[model samples]
Every structure is written in C-alpha cells, then in structure tokens.
Target: MWYNIDFYIWAVNLLVIRLRKPKMIAFVKSLVTPIVNIHYDFLQKKAIDEFILNHNGQVCYLRKALNDVFDNELRRIRIGSGNQYNRQYIYTRAEQKPVYLGKIYIRDKSAFADTGIDYIVYVPKKILASRELELIKWIEIFNEAGTAYKIIGE
Candidate 1:
C-alpha cells in the first residue's frame, strides 16, 4: 500500500540521517581543528613568553655560578647564532688571558614548565675535567632545590 511505502521511505530517511549525523559533526570538527590549533599555539606562545620574562633573572645567577665569580657582574655572551650554546662568561684571573671558556647551555627543563626552565645545565664539549666535579656540585645545589640538571655534550 501507499502508506507502507511512505513509512518505509520515512524510516530509511531517519536511519540515513542518524547514521550521517556523527560523520557530519566529525567533518565539521575537522574543519575547525586548524583554527583551534592556531589559537592554542598562540596562547601557548604567550604563556611561554610571560614565563620567560618572569624567570630571565635566573640567567644572572646562572652566569655567576658558571663563571665562579659571584661578586663580579656576569658578562655572559651568546656564542653561536642559535641559543643551543653560549659562553656564560670569560674568567680572566690574574695573569691568565680571557679564556673562550665558561660556555654553558641553560636549556629548557621541559617544553612545558611554566617558569620557562628550571636548573638543568647542559655542559659544553670543552669544559675542563678539573672543573667538571665542581660544575656538577654547583648544579647539584640547584638540583637539590627541586631543580634537576644534566651534563650533555658531544
């Protein structure tokens, strides 16, 4: 009968709509994902910048520690173009020439710490063995204060 055919058509249409509803929603969500990601990235960058700004003062302390001259104003200068490694300071004592030493990398503790980075000193390739224990001890002090450090080099 006509009524039975109409009912079948109506049921099929309802079934099709029910099946397609979630797929349509997923497609729309996929389209919005890029925009959501951009916003998330923007917010993350802002938070990181704020965190860096707040914690950059630790750099001076790090410089003083690395230079082993707490009293002297640290004159740490970036070594290469990128921030992977940098000379924390030049220790020029008594008759010694300005050594191209005191290099260090105060890298990010994690990509997620809010203070930008905790006490994790990445050791450079050329630190003197004599200074290694001292450096480790110094880093240990910070590490004990809930800031962990590691010695990584080539």
Candidate 2:
C-alpha cells in the first residue's frame, strides 16, 4: 500500500511539472523582453501618437488591411488561429484553410511550409504610397482606442 501511494505521488508530481512547463516558458519569454522599452522616447512617442491620430483610433483598419492583402493566402495556408504578445499579434489560419502570420518561430521547415503567412505588406512601401495619409489616419484611430503599437524600423 505504501509503495502504491509513493508511485501515485510521483505520478502526480510529474503531471504537475508537465502541465506547468508551457506556462513557465511563456512567462520567461515575457520577462526576457521588455515590451514597451524604447531607445528613443521622443521618436517612439511621436510615432505612436501620430499613428493614433492618423488612424482616428481604430483597430479594424489593421485587420482590414491584413484581410485585404492576405485573406486568400491565409486560407490557402490553413492557419486559423492567432496569439498576441504585447504589440505583436500573430494570426494562424489553419482551420479549413492554412495561413500563418506574424513572427512565427517554427522548428520544422515542412510545418512552416504547410502553414505560413501568405502575404506580407512591406511597411516602407505602404508608408510611401499615396494611400499613406489615409493609412496613417486609420492607425491614429487605433491609438485612440488605447492599442499599443510597435514600429519595426526608425
């Protein structure tokens, strides 16, 4: 009876450890990277503020732009879920279709190929286009909605 109890305890402990691993990893990842750290406060603030103002504080524009450019591709890739971390948002479109978006770190190339972000909008080009002004306005709306944004480049 004692031996059975000991084995049961050990099994329970192992199960607990296993269940905690993913949460621990996610926590560690969050701590290692400062989500809001900005090297140039002024620049970051201005960019963020401008984006908010330009977008008139709407988050839908980002989704719209993404859908417009990559909805079909996402469907093709079969990535149908998304994970959010700070200012970074990842979308996986793997339900009936397959498309993965955002910074995906996959160990297997085949898996990546099977499910990857179909379309990527070039920031600079989007910024330079005639529609830039409109895009900025939309981004500003998102800001007003209290959404944090991360500018990839200076």
Candidate 3:
C-alpha cells in the first residue's frame, strides 16, 4: 500500500511539471541576450545639447567632444544591483534586447547617496511590468546626465 501511494505522488509531480508553462524561462533567456545593432548619432547630438544647456552654454573638455561622452562614461564606472534601497522600480528590461547591461554612477561629488549616484540602468532577468519603459528611461539618463557606468554581473 505504501509503494502504491509513493507511485501516485510521483505521477502527480510529473504531470504538474509537464503542464507548467515556460514563460519564466523564456523571459530569462531574452534578458540574457541583447541586440547590439543601432546608431548613436542622434543621441550624441542630444547629449551635446543637454551638456551645453546644463553648463550654461559653456563648452568644456567633455562638452566639446560629446561623442566621447558615452564611450568614456557609459563603458566605465561600475554597475550596481539596485538592491541597496530595495526599490522595485530599479529592475530593468529591453524591448528588443540591448547593446549592453549595467549601472550608472556619478563620476564626481563625493559622499552622494548610493541610490542617487548609482542607478541600475540595465540588466538581464528583469522583473515587474512596465520594466521595458523604465529601462529606456534609465539608459537615456545614464547617457545624457554625464554619469559613468560599468557592468557588474556581466
């Protein structure tokens, strides 16, 4: 009788596993891979405009060569988990994958709040709805705001 009961339980477990959907795994795989084809000329123009406006129309070292801004800052620094504050809005996603993933941290200003200076702008295995929109917003912020970033888990 005990052997029969054990077999019954095993059969039920197998059925459940087979019936389970694979949405979660699909989401993870998508996040793990990102599309890297795109143009940045428009963004470069926007970044330059933003810098000049923010700096009172002054062309400083970085402002003069704004195209280098993304290459210099975005590819540098370090990516954070965005878990320091346990904020739910920080998790990110890509609409059609991304060129990269990482966090953005302020280059200057010592002792700034961790959350304020570092934003988990991009990552794989994103959660929460509307994360796609959030990712786009944060990437723009990281690129245009003069913040530096680096990949952590990648």
Candidate 4:
C-alpha cells in the first residue's frame, strides 16, 4: 500500500509538469529580452524621422546647435499646458521668474507657399533681461523667434 501511494504521488507531480505550457514561457521571455535594444532603437528612430518630417528637417540640425548653447537651460524648462491641441513650455528665467511659450496656428496666402504651420512664444513681463537674452540667443542660433514666431506646430 505504501509503495502504491508513493507511485501515485510521483505520477501526479509528473502530470502537473507536463501540463505546463512551454509556449507561454517562451512568449513572456520574448517580450522582455528585445525591449532593451530593439524597442528603444525603433522608438528613437521614429522620433527623429517624425521631427524631420514636421519641421522640414530643420529641427534635427537646430537641435544639435541648440544643444551646444541652451542644453542646460532647456533641461530646466517644463512643458506648461495643452493636450492634443498645442505644445507649450514654461521656463523660469535667470531672475527666477517664469515665462510661457507655445505654438498657435499657421496659414499661407501665397500660391507657392508651404502651409507648414505657425507657432508662438510668450514671455512674461516679470522675466529678467539676462534670462531673456539667453532665451533670445537660443532662438537666434536656432533661427527661431522670440515672443512671436511661426513654425510647424507639432
């Protein structure tokens, strides 16, 4: 009787092991491993391509040049508001006052014009001259605008 009981227990364990799905384990491992390299690379490339398409490829070149100057400042700035409607940023100036900037709309009247888009940059009156100058320098370096300008609104 003891021998029969031991055999039954062993058979139950073997059955449970056999019933486990190998494909489920494989599916989970597949989701985790490629996430590091493959998914990240694809996302980075997609972002670059999208930026190029929206800004006529100027955003790519501008990003490199702007990084040299205002990369630190840019890091400090925060996107202020807007959902699917507009993109906005709020930056605290060197004097510790906040400025809000954003893109509004775009329209073209010329027949040959590319109705790309238009944008807006807003600066609060409380911002200091030094911070304003730094922001303007970045805008000039990037061939962008200050207080008001037009670009593709993404």
Query: RMSD of each candidate?
Result: 19.5, 26.1, 25.9, 20.8
Query: lDDT of model 3 at residue 145?
Result: 55
Task: Rank the models by lDDT, top first.
Answer: 1, 4, 2, 3
lDDT of 2 by residue, 57-147 (tens): 2234555543343343442211122222223234455544434454755343322322332322234443335455554454444443433
Write down the TM-score of every candidate.
Answer: 0.28, 0.21, 0.16, 0.23
- Put the candidates in TM-score order, highest first: 1, 4, 2, 3
Give lDDT per model, in order: 0.47, 0.39, 0.39, 0.42
Q: Which candidate is the best by lDDT?
A: 1
* Residue 16's lDDT in candidate 1: 45
**Candidate 4: tens digits of C-alpha lDDT, residues 1-154:** 2312333234334544655466654554455565445656766887756644444224445544434334435432222211124333355577565564445354243211233333333333333233667655555544544322332212
The residue ranges of model 3 lying beyond 4 angstroms of the native Cα positions read 1-116, 125-142
After superposing candidate 1, which stretches have Cα over 4 Å from the reference? 1-20, 58-122, 126-154
Clashing pairs in 3: 76-149
Candidate 1 TM-score over all chains jointly:
0.28
Q: Poorest 10 consecutive residues of model 1 by lDDT?
A: 75-84
Compared with the true structure, the alpha-carbon lDDT of candidate 2 equals 0.39
Runs of candidate 2 exceeding 4 Å displacement: 1-61, 65-127, 150-154
On residues 1-154, what C-alpha lDDT tens digit does candidate 1 reach at each position? 2312333234335554556566665665566667666766777887756543443225454544555422234333211212233324555587587766554556553423453344345445456244677666544453435444445442
